[model samples]
Structure formats: C-alpha cells, structure tokens
Target: MQTITSARMAAIDTNCEYLGIKRLQLMENAGAAVASAVKERISSGKVVIIAGRGNNGGDAFVAARHLGGYDVTVILIGKKEDLKTPEALHNWNVLEKTSIPLVEFTNSTFFDPSILKNAKVIIDGIFGTGVRGRIHEPESTIIDLINGSGAFVLSVDVPSGFDPDGGEFDKAVHAGLTLTFHKMKTGFLSQNAQQYTGEIRVVDIGIPIEAEFYVGPGDIQPFLKRPAISHKGDAGRILVIGGGPYSGAPALSALSALRAGADIVTVAAPKNVSDIIASYSPNLIVKKLTGEILVEDDIPIISRLIEKHDVVVMGMGLGNADETLLAIEKIVPLCTKAVIDADALSPQLVPFLDKNMILTPHAGEMKRLSGNDVPDEQKERIEFIKSFAQKNEVTVLLKGAIDLISDWLEVRANRTGNAGMTVGGTGDVLAGLTGALFARCKSPLEAAACGAFINGAAGDMAFKEFGYGLLATDIIDYIPAVMKA
Candidate 1:
C-alpha cells in the first residue's frame, strides 16, 4: 500500500547494489515477474515486447528469455549499441545469442505500426519512470501503435511516457495492466493515472530492507550532479559562525564545506582567532568579529553575512558563554537555513526549531538539548530521533556509530562510519558537509542523511590507508572521491 517516488526508487536501486544486490539479479526477478504476469493472463500467443534502450528494456529481454516456449518477439526501440545500462546491454547480449525474433528501430522512420496488429499481448517497456516532457521519435509513434493494436498490454514498471513523479504526460501507453516494481509509484495515486495504468501490481525485486532504511551512495546522487550552465554560487554559499575558544574546529568546517562542493565558504570568527582560521586556508573568506568571543554587538554584521549566504553552519567551537549563547539566539532566528552543531546545540535554540534548521548533535549534546539519553538499542534510538524531529519540527542528524537522520516523517540510519571517525574534528566535518547539502537540497532530512553518509564514507576511505590514524582533515580530503563513487 506504500508508494515511492521514482527518484527515491532509483536511490533504493543504487543502495540495493551497495548492499550486494546486483542490478542483473533485480532485472532477472523483475523480468520473471513480468513473464509470470503474462502467463497468468494468457498461456501462449505471438507475444510482442516493445522495449526501449534502458533497464525497462532489460526487463523485457529477461522476460523474453523466461517465456521460452511461447512465440515471443522483441522489438528494441533503439539500437543495441545505444542500450543505456550495463545490465540492459548484458540482457540484450543474451537475447542476441538466442533464437527469439528480434527487431530494432533506431529511428522514427523504422517503426512499423502494422507489426502490432497480430500481437496477442504487447509488453510495453519503452520508458519506465525515468522519462518526462514531450514524447520523442519512435517511442511516440510506437505508443500510438500499441494503443491502437487492441492487444492485452502489460506495461513494465509504469505506463511508458507517464511522469511517475507528477502523474502527467504528453502521451502514454494505455496499459491493461501495469507491472510496477518494489512499490507502487507515487504518480499512480493521482486521479487521472488509472486511465493509463489500468490494473497495477506491485512487484518485489528483492531489494534489501537496508537499501531503503540506510543511507548509502544512492542517497547522494542527485546532489552530486550539476547543470552545465550553473553560475558560481549555484552549488552553495555557506557562512560558518564558530571559533573564539578554538580555531581548528571552524576552519575544519569551512574547509570541509568547500570539499563537499560548496562554492563559497566564509568564516565569521572573533578577531583574535580570525587570522588563525584564515591562515588554515587561502580559500576561506574570513570576517573578523570584535572581542575575545561572540557577543550581542556582532549581531548586526553577522545578520548581513547571513543574508548573503545560502546557509549558516554555526557553533563548531564557540564556547558556552552566556553572551555568546545570547548572540546565537539572535543570529539563528536570522538564518533562513542553518546546520547547528557543537556548543550551539543548546535548549535556548529549541523555540527556533522551525524545520529550516538541521541539528547535528553527538550523544552528550543531544541529551543536553532533549533532556533524554540516546538509547543504545537501534530501534528505540530511531523512534527517539524520529519523535524529537517531529516534535521540534526540525531535521535531526544524530552522530554516533550509527548516524540517525530524521525529519519526522522518515528516519534513515547511516552505517558508513567506523571507530576511527571518533576523531575530534569529524563532527565538524559532518556539520560543514551537511551545510553544503542543506543549501541545495529540497528535503532537510535528505541533506542530513546524505551528508552523514558522505562524511562517514569519506572517513572509511581515509581509514583504508590511515587506519586509526585517520584525521578529520583526511576525511575532508576524500569527499570528492566519495561523491564520485
């Protein structure tokens, strides 16, 4: 009964592989499910598979292999060389070695509508959930042909051409049945979706629970991609407010923010530590605030800086002085979005937990703010984190051996980190990484979840060579590698 967005489904698929479930194995299961669905409808006939050059097509190829004795013919909507995924290409290679009739339509001119006239059942695997916007070329022509053919049409994943996220389309296949995978697509719940989807069956592709529940490489994919024509600050412009008691923490956060793909990172530190923080990196833009520590007088200048930045990553090493805490109270309300961490995680900030803030807290800090101990048991901890996020209406990134991220509605646990990450400044790195992601991400929970995953995964990579000697700076150095992965 649960529904997932196509984007989330793709994330889950990638996570499944991260957990050792290969794409080929999932394709086999999906195809077998499609083949079984066809058999249930009608045993034997001239079954025509209309497939695209992606995973949807791969599923059709697997189904064709499974329907061995039946008269199955596969019509690939694009050239074999154009198959998009390795799994799709692998299945196509398998079909090429078989005796099944195969047809390839590389262009619009190659389509033959009359070919569908005699098809007892048409498997529409042209465009699963990935497609959006206007229908193109052979796929457009083929959709019309399949609709007019009057065959028992079974669409794979989703009705081809239907926007599985929005439930709108330029044109789509009118399937008699839609064999969706893993879960019902969110788009199918729309009022008009049933016209194209018909009877829908949610197919299980054997995705592990860890894939959906845990943060992995899949969770960060959307954030890593950039538009070709993006401007300088399109990634993120972060304003880090820390330092005073210690300079290293804020500098680490600022450096990690840049390493995590933030375009510009500025550090606002007390005049004494400002030079020291700036000396750590030539890249950082340091704004020196007056006095030994943050005070109410610095609020005006900090407010101006906050307006210029996309997100405020605050409280890395700004100690718990009363004047400094009062300054934090004023500055936090000014931030449109913030990643609150370290000494900044105070009960005074609770009233301002307006869902725009991401709170990253270790066990002691979390207990300080929530007045409750973080349970050792994972289930109880998850519920505790979720409940806190819901009640506060804020995103919570609880840092521990198992990082827990929650935005009330959904809770994701990240298991990418290790014992080596207990290093002092790793939490600062995570706070900065989270600030970078939160600036661009639509969901605070997603940004926190992916940030935790990236921070820990990078730590894991650093641990490979550095072992227990892994430093927080080492984690920052490997951020791009983790993103690339």
Candidate 2:
C-alpha cells in the first residue's frame, strides 16, 4: 500500500495542477467520495456538515449537493463571506442556491444544539488535515456539542483538531469513520491517532502516480509554514563561510539564501573580498576575517559563529588552497547542518561529510570526492552517485542536465533545468538555495531535491525570458517567482 505525509500530499496536488488537472475537479471528486462514504454508513437520515470557511468547507458543500436522498443542513463554522479560497467560496455560493438549510457559526449562542443532536450523521469538516494546535472559539464549544451528541460522525480527511503529522493537540474529533483522500496522512497509523481516526479508508481522487514520483513546485511545502506570532530567526539564520579569490560566489550564495526565504544571512569571508561581498547586498551581514584566503587560524572564530546559525553553507569561491581545505575540514564538522560546495568539495572534506550535510557537486568534484569517474550515460551516473552516497552515508546532489539527489537509501531525479543553466555562478545559487531550505526542511534529502527543482525551474523560467543569454543572476531573479508559483 502507498502512503503520503501531509506535505507530500500537498506536493502531489500541486503537481496534479502543474500537469493540467483542475483544482475544482479534485474538490468535486473529494466531495463525491465523502458523500459516498456517508451514504455507505447511513441509508437515509438528517445530515449536518460542520464546515469551516476553507477548502474543507468546500468539500462539505460538494458532499451536501451529492447527498440528495438525505435531509442536509450546512452549519458553516464562520461567516459566509470569510471564505479565503476561490474553490471553497465557489462551493459555498453553489450551496446557497439549494434548498438545504444553511446556518453560520457566528458565536457559541447562535447555533442550535438540536441540529447536532438530531443529526443521524454529522460531517466533521471544521478543519482539514493542515490544522494544528488547540481547538478554539465557537468550534471549541461546537466540538463539545458534537461529542456530546449520539451522532454517527464521518470526518473529512482526519478528524478536525488532529495534526496530520502526529503531535499533541488541545482537542481532536473522535470520528467513527475517517474518509481520507488519495493516500493516508502523516498520523494515520500512529497508536495515539487510531482512536481519534476510527476506521480509516483511503479514497482515490485520481491524483496520478507520476505526481508522487516527480519533484514540483509543491515540494517547497515544508518551507512555507508562517505562524502569525512567529518570532525573529524563526525561518532560518544561515551562516555562509566563503569568498576571497572570487567575491561574487559568496554574494550570490547569500542573496540566494535570502531569496529562498532565510530570515538572516551572514557571510564570513576573507579580508580581500569581505567588503566587496558586503557591497553586493546591504541585506547580507558580513563578518570580516584577517587573510585573503581561508587559513587554519580562522577555525576558532568560524566555530563560534557556527553555533549561532541554524545551517552553515561553506565553500563558495574560497579558492581550493591547502590552507582552505584545512579550514573546511575544521569548520564543516563543527557546524550542525551545512551545504558543502565549490572549493569546499575537496577529498579532505569527505571525512566531515555526514547526513546533515548536503554536497552539491558537478562531474569533476564528484569524481574527486569518490575517486570514481562519472559515466556520461544517465543510468550509470545515477547508479554511481547512489552507490557513492550509500557508501559514504552522506547526501549527494549531482549537478547536471538532470540533477540526481540521493541520501543513500532514497533518490530523486529533477529534470526542471535547461541547457542554458551552464553559467558560472549558478551552482552557488543552488547551494545557497539548498542551505536555506535545509534550515527549515526536516530531511536533508527533501531540501536538496527541492533546491534542485526550484533552481532548475527558475533557470527554465529565465531561459524563457532570455534564450541562450541566460545568466546565473537571472536564475536568482526568478527564484521568488518560481517559489511563489
């Protein structure tokens, strides 16, 4: 049996749309599935859908329209005008035309408790799988009413108030049957969720298998969590150790980190190019070192700085000198999470490489790291890279026409980039993007895969704007647009 976490499910849906599947069609299919599940449980009775003003409510509205044999009443948990998504609001408008009773959840006292008490089947669509934390307000009071009633509950997806990823919650719905879509969610199999989830049934809404296998704009789902009350440095505080012999490499990296949504980016560079790198962007926090290139002496201060940031991105234009390699060996291992690229991909740095580190290497750097020649053929290259990653127990992102990201056991191939991405500084942008994403993503492999996809997709977008004239900076310019899409 195949399964998907909430993040993966969302990514798959995004890919579905990217592949030309309409969002409204998926919603209709989801609603039809919910209605069928409800009908299977109850032959005929009064049905009450407790809906929130979101996609979840849209699903309920679709279900209400399909349940023609039952006496349906929609208890919208919020104002009808409050629906934020177009699909949800569209469904809400459609339900308004029908004769089914439409009630709004204005306050605790406004809704009739008898509606829930008299319901033979109550659809718990107050929240979808994305919801987290404590159940509050009218919904909190309504949750008590629903639980208090003898109604046969049919929850849309996981029960409302349940964290699909599995966690502690203030309150959660106890459903007799949970009609999950496409695949099972994050917490579906956990022992803590079994009682709350009830008899779980996976519904096929026709999301293609290719959606699951391919990397798309949806892969960035994990990086998009923005809480209303989030504090500073909540997104990511990235420390970049590079610069010197060449300045723009680290500058490109820091800017890439910033563009990829890292809250703060600090570049620690040599004296020769620290000012130059700093001048590239006022957004970058520059830490000036004593020498022209990385030396053994810089390790102590770099180690101290590493403690302050969430992820460290090392070796973008720090020339491949002997002292620089020594610096990389000393600095990379002390850091918690890192992206080792550019001049930092020396053989000596391999000992410091771990699962927490993402190594972005082209053919030459890959050959140097593994002492194995990379075959020109795609299949052989994948096998070689996969084997090397497994043997080293490190994440390897092989940069090429088709990027191959592997974390020993699992692998993902990203074909989003075009031939125009052969420009000089693009790899640095990719490394920075990966580090920025690495700070937020739970898995290093996921971050690397998303990094490759976004960088390549942005490159493709740039290619569309400017043919063979595509520059590395152009990819950087397109990062936000690609991510937003």
TM-score: which candidate is best? 1
Residue 136's lDDT within candidate 2 is 75
Judged by lDDT, which candidate is best? 1
**TM-score of candidate 2 to 2 decimals:** 0.84
Q: Residue 438's C-alpha lDDT in candidate 1?
A: 88
- Model 2, runs deviating above 4 Å: 1-8, 99-101, 108-110, 116-119, 221-237, 243-247, 261-301, 304-310, 319-327, 373-386, 440-442, 480-485
Residue 458 lDDT, candidate 2, scale 0-100: 90
Predictions in order: lDDT: 0.92, 0.87
What's the residue-level lDDT of 225 in candidate 1? 88
Model 2: lDDT to the true structure: 0.87
- TM-scores of all candidate predictions against the true structure: 0.97, 0.84
RMSD of 2: 3.6
Error of model 2, residue 219, in angstroms? 3.5
What clash pairs does model 1 have?
none
Writing each residue's lDDT as its tens digit, candidate 1 over 1-485 gives 58999889999999989898999999999999999999998888889999999999999999999998888989998789899999999999999999999998887445767778788899999987889899988688789889999899999999999989865579999999999999998889888888999999998889888899999888899988889999999999999999999999999999999998999999999999999999998999999998889999999889999989999999999999999999998888898999999999999989877788999999999999999998989999999989999899999999988899899899899999899998899999999999999888868899999999999999999999899999999999999999883
Alpha-carbon RMSD of each model: 1.4, 3.6
